[model samples]
Target: MRGLFLLTLALMVPGGVQATLPPPPGGPTPAPRLVSFAPPPSVVVCKGGEARVVESAPIHARIWQPWIPPVIGRAAHQIPPPPAPPTADIYTFSIDADGAVIDLSRPMAPTMWPGDEQAAALAKWRFAPGAPIKGCRLDLAPTTVALS
Candidate 1:
């Protein structure tokens, strides 16, 4: 886990990681990791190596967290307005040759949902890194967490 945390930290550091989304055509394209039940938009950027998801770590985020109950008022119209939804972003992670998540970042614009715990959880994703494939990608979107 420490390794994963360090790796996640490294990924957050600017210019510390090496993995690209699909570039303009004519360049070596990243290969899909495998046949996915969900649409796999990203791929592993390996050299003739194939990787399969040995195990997918479950990413748990409370959809509505820290719910603050409204104070009771006899007026009966004091129900606090519902909490607004938190902003979200798409985080793309890269798996290393060892199948551990080595890099994580928001390919899109910066978002409120910081990728800290998300990184730790994503780090646990296990992959079958055969033939030393350059590695594959996993994109995630975190929902606003709330206390039940």
Candidate 2:
């Protein structure tokens, strides 16, 4: 009876068996690191009567999504009229592998003002070097003119 009680006591103790096992070994985990970037300098010269050089680019346009409230206004409060849309302006410009300029009319649309102006600027202008653009152009409409 004494020997049987000792055996039962050993089994009942916490970690009595697992404590005899060997410890596990360590391992490494691989990770990624970033590198540096450097760009070159460039200059643009515009000549002639409001001339611009616009290289075409892939249009990355997104659809305009406006959210409307459930009700126009509160029932009790009187609301003033919403402000009118700003006057639309025309713009034009051109781009190359390096850079671009805006407000060169040459019959094209505008760059700074609105979509319709930009479309008109694109339709009328021409480009040089024939390279692509991931760039932008900005200029006041009609009054402002550029040469590139």
User: lDDT of all the models against the reference?
Assistant: 0.49, 0.36
Model 2: per-residue Cα lDDT over 1-148, one tens digit each:
9999989999899767554544332222112222111111122233322223444322222222222223333442343333222233323345544434444443443232245534543554445543544333333222211121
- Candidate 1, which segments miss by more than 4 Å at Cα? 1-50, 63-88, 142-148
- With candidate 1 superimposed using the best TM-score fit, by how many Å does residue 29's alpha carbon deviate from the native? 47
Error at 13, model 2, angstroms? 99
TM-score of each: 0.41, 0.23
**What are the RMSD figures for all models against the true structure?**
26.2, 20.9
Q: Residues 53-80, candidate 1, lDDT per residue (tens digit)?
A: 6766555543333243434332334544
C-alpha lDDT of residue 125 in model 2 = 43
List the candidate 2 regions with Cα displacement exceeding 4 Å: 1-79, 87-114, 130-133, 139-148
Best by TM-score: 1
- Global local distance difference test of model 1: 0.49
